[model samples]
Target chain A: MPPLPVITGLGFITSIGQDRATVGRSLRELQHGFERVEFFGNPNLPVKVAGTIKGFDFPTPSWRDWRWPDRFTVDRELLRGLAPHGVYALCALQQALTEAGLEPGELGDGTTGLFCASAGSPFMLGSFLGQMRETRGERGNPMGVVSSIAGTLNFNLATHYRITGAVCGFVSACASSSHALGYAMDEIRLGRQQRMLVVGAEDMTDESIMAFSSLRALSNNPDPATASRPFDRRRDGFVGTGGAVALIVEDAALARRRGAHIIAELIGWGQAGDGHSVTASHPEGAGLREAMRRSLADARVNARDVGYVNAHATSTVAGDRSEALALHATFTSQGARPRVSSTKALTGHGLSLAGVMEAAFCALAIDEGFIPGAAHLEEPDPVCTGLDLPRTSLAEAPGLVLNNSSGFGGSNVCHLLRRPA
Target chain B: MKTSAPSPTASTEHEQSIRHLPAPARAAFEQFQAGGDPATLDPVVLAILADFSPRASEIPLADLPGDTMLIDDLGFDSLAITEVVFAAEDLFRINITNEEIVQVRTLDHLRGFIRAKVAGRSAR
Candidate 1:
């Protein structure tokens, strides 16, 4: 059997934080990263809040005008065909590679591969497509296809990094990055590649984010603090957010030989789908429950040994209920209680990025010796009544951590992680 | 993405393969791309080329006269050409067809193309 894949390097660019130290501090202090703003600048839109990303400039959705923190030096050529989210992903990748002591531009020896997930740059698509339509379909930006589609990340990132290994784009919506991570693990475990870079990013634009409001899945509450109260009875809906997160999933044996500091071991992962509904999960959280059980069984660890669970409860009424029911059936009702919380209560739901971002949080918790607690859970829902939803950070190192991530197509993926031995 | 060249290597090789043509074509391209005052290129057209040609900002836009190589002398890829065309269209309020974009190898070609379009529109 192959050694488990370990997370050696992590790079984060999220609403809550952008680095290990800042992210650790934010999670530890329960700092809520939210802001009230009229998406689309249209007063008629219902939702007025989001977990807005800070310290980035987006005067226009165009990548040319978009500027992240000046600390990272990026070539102008690389930005030509990118969207805002692509830039974020690249910036996050820089951080990850640096932490892993991997040199950029030299990672193309075929040992390193890249997998990326993003909802795509809808705002940039709107801009480019708008131009095409206005021009009567004659001509538009040449990079329209590579910069806007769901697979944009694969094309741009793979070509940029020049990875010769398996490069794929996962599009399971919110569960996209989890699928990427899972496949990356298989690639490393199968000895196909020494390491794999998994990146997930999303555009924080009216076209990209407010489009979800059409489904009424976004919080209508104007108050940023209480807008994303996952697992709470008063929770209205998930608050949307965007940015990028990245992880370097390396082979444990390779990492150990190279003396790389492993943050967490991705012991096992499992994925299942809810065949019942197109958008909603199984009413009883059947798919999620199965995913958790499969993950535990795959990891060959007792369910009772799992110390922390990063719940996928996104604060939506039905979504939270579904996840809570799944949690109860999987752990609580089985007499094995685990500390559970939805970090979404602070960071908001980052859609496709949720999987990798939450998983990275688990890695941070293990590395920083703190478990992030649910931020604004004043009142628990009836389904989550027996669940332990700590409303603040737990100042203890977690033994076994499970991160749950689900998507619109009823796709579900769960990962089991633990502190490196 | 569509670029002026089907491929950068192919375009560069194609231009260089023609021993005599590449120098003149490159000269014309360099003059216009370098923002040099080529008598055939209008100052406005030269400015647009200079601005969009990746690193041609240091080239004097409306001063020198002479052409330079066209393909792969610098890193101006196909996407940059599309951007140049888009900017030229918006600035001159003229629509340039793919055929016209393909014919423009040097800054002189671009000047001729845009000058004719702007002149034709004014005459109309």
Candidate 2:
């Protein structure tokens, strides 16, 4: 039998924290990062608050990093065109590669692959449109097209890291990164690649926030801590935010040979489409339930053996109720109930990064021996009852943790992870 | 046709080089130089052309002919030309739309387009 794929290196930047250790601490302490929307705020925009990473300091290329004097001109051009999401992905990629002890040349291995997820480059699109308006359509940046593409972040990471392997980007709205992670694990498990880097990065631009506001899919509450109240009766909508997460999955044996720190074993992954609605999810969460069942079966673990679940609750009325119904059905059918919580309450449903960051949190929980609670989940809606929605962090080591992520167009993904033995 | 000599206001190296070009190209350069609008100034055109030269790749900006077809002579694909248009927009503070780019077939056409745009902006 083929060895299971395991996450050997983890790096992420969220509204809550910039690294695994920091984010893990925040998760354990139930520290919420939602605050007033700083960059995307507009009086006309319905939602006034969002989760944002305050004081994020991005890195600049040094003389040695760019191999200056020789490739300075080309390097400068590339740097000039990088969008915010690309920068975040590159930063997280650097950290993950460093943690995996893999250099650029090592990433060039034929068996290494990259699977990245992003919804779109809102910031780049805004810049392009601004240029168009200011110049009256006369001229614009040549790199705008490249920067605005949805696949820009993945392409940049692959080219920058010199990884010539299969590089792909997933765009299933909020489920994008979960699908990326799922496909990456399949690639490694099926012997298509020995290692893969899964990345999820997104930026909250004014355009995105405004669009969501128009859709009434954002919280209007002014209080930062209570803005994203997943499972609560007064829940309004998700809090938009910018976030990124990266994980290096390698063949378990390969990781063991390299003495890599195995965060957790990626036991199983499943994806499904609702096929019911273009925008709204199925009323019963059919796709979500199927995804979880398939994931649990693929892992060959009983539902009773699963100890925890990190939900994709985005703090919306319909979204939370649908997910709750799905979880109750899936767990009750198996005659076992696992503790469930939505870290989105803290991270504010970071769209593209939601699944990947939640996966990162599960890996951290495996190492830290604690599961974070659903922050601000005070008055759980009666519809979202029956599951153990802990209001405080639980000091317990779960043997298996399931992360459920769903998105617009009714896409759903479930990734099953196991504690490192 | 009376071709005016290079303008006194522009003493850049590009202007000096333009004076030696054969009649038509040098006349066009003189007309652009005498316009006095910063958008159609010699330095701005040269900078845009310089930025575009690398993208055009086949010929250097210095040897570029005024009537050279964008795709035929300069080897610019649609995406490549889009970059050039963007560069031109930034350099001259003008906007060239997709439709306008289609009408621009030659370097001379591009110069005329810029001159007309500058004239319109000045009239505004």
Candidate 3:
């Protein structure tokens, strides 16, 4: 309904790394984060590997107010201190404020809002389920009980930042953060707020692994090095990964006048729901096509203007094929196709964090002028022949990039990004 | 809270009795065995529930008391209670109501609720 706000600053933590430079270096070197299961229980399960964040340390009692920090310990512990979705949002907001040379108290209390996306039910529920199984017929510890809900984490973040504006969590599965980003952009553009912090975060849990494994939707490769081969013919399935990514979105005019280092412009965002089955995608990629087409139209850019696509290919059988079909349809309609790549091969599907991870990738790509290729893509699926998927390494400079995140419940979202002049 | 009249089916009764699970009471055992026997309650599920209400594991089967607080005594918070209810429903293949959950706080009360609902459902 309104023009999208510009992204002023960004912060992200993934299996790859915790900061932009570190993650970028890893991406350039084609380093991966997947590894064999070790710490978590039942390592002998069919899906025994994941992209786990190693040796992360969150701020402790000595660093921050113990009471304030304890409230978010549930998420912090889950992430090993990489910052939960809400903490990530706060860090990104702070970075943007600092870059814009604004003070922590500058925006006032009620003017700043927080919108975040996450597969809310999974992490907490899965943990609770696991606990329930372990202590059958036994009463649970109160501390563990309160810490496992989706809302608690969001509330903790809002409380910690003392944000008084609208604070809400979106649970549209994988589209969670994308939807949150879109909402925050609209809020700023429509004058709901001059600034908003949007974030996406997820915690990898054994239940998540089991669920994906049950659906046969994960790569079973034991070698963490080559596990997440997106778009590769031998790609088994997506490797589950976890992390948080945050972006500070603000009104472009305000940012310009303030001399903020505007990283990229959030030209447009489009979201569509297929009303399809809970887990299965529509055969023709109807919802995905509409989302992309609408995003492009909203950005007032032609198909040819799009230089790269960050695909939502989780390497699942149905998901990969369906996304490919959708891309083929979108590009073919305009008589040209953009080079496509899947960062999931690098970061694993961050679930709720996938969109933000890809968004960060887009921002970095635009700034650096090179698009990162989908790692481990040796052979392409015959059904995906129509798409121009990059395989070898980072190649062409990207002027504009599109990040796609299609989730369960048939929710599809697309964000279009353009390099800042 | 207003308690709904108990249903007449076996499954419905089981679903309705979740709220009355007392400290250390076994709420979802029968249901957990619905798809044949599971050999044991899933360890992960047990661990999560125990974390929610430690007394759930601390209370002995012989010492199960009717008046113990699910939250205060057994540690079943709002979220934990919700999970327990869902787990029972999944195990028993029955849909439960929030009202029913609200009324359950003791082991006997939960058993009665499930017994009534299961009987009511079977009558149909």
Summarize candidate 3's per-residue lDDT along A1-421 as a digit string, tens digits: 3545887777766788766787777766677777787434665676756877654432221112122222122332222212233344444445445545666566546877888766543544554566557546332322343334565446656665677888998888888889888888789877888788777877555654557777778887877767787767788888997767778788887778788878888899898988888998888888998999999988899888898999999887778888888988888667877888888888889888888778888887786667887787878888778788777557567878999999998999999999875
lDDT comparison, 1 vs 3, better candidate = 1
List model 2 lDDT by residue over A200-228, tens digit each: 99865565555777778888888898999
Give the lDDT ranking, best first.
1, 2, 3
The residue ranges of model 1 lying beyond 4 angstroms of the native Cα positions read: B1-41, B55-67, B93-100, B106-124
Which scores greater on DockQ, model 2 or model 3? 2
Model 2 vs. true fold: TM: 0.77
Best candidate according to TM-score:
1
- In angstroms, the error of model 2 at A110 is 1.7
* Predictions in order: lDDT: 0.81, 0.76, 0.68
Writing each residue's lDDT as its tens digit, candidate 1 over A1-421 gives 5767999899988898888788889999999889887776788877988888788877775554576787876666677678778878888888998898778776798888898899888888988899778656755777888888898888888888888878999999999998998889888878899889999999887887888887888888888879999988898889999989999999888888888899999998998999888888888898999999889998898789988999999999999899999998998877988899999998999999999999999999988888898898888898888888887899998889999999987899999999988
Index of the highest-DockQ prediction:
1
- Lowest-lDDT window of 10 residues in candidate 2 chain A? A63-72
Q: Please write out the lDDT profile of model 2 over residues B32-76, one tens digit for every residue.
A: 647656343544554455444424254555467778887786656
lDDT tens per residue, model 3, B1-124: 2212222236565444343343333433544445333323333234334433423364553355656566766755565576565554444444567877888875555555554554454455
Error of 1 at A108 (Å): 0.6
Residue runs of model 3 more than 4 Å from their true location after superposition: A1-4, A57-103, A121-146, B1-124
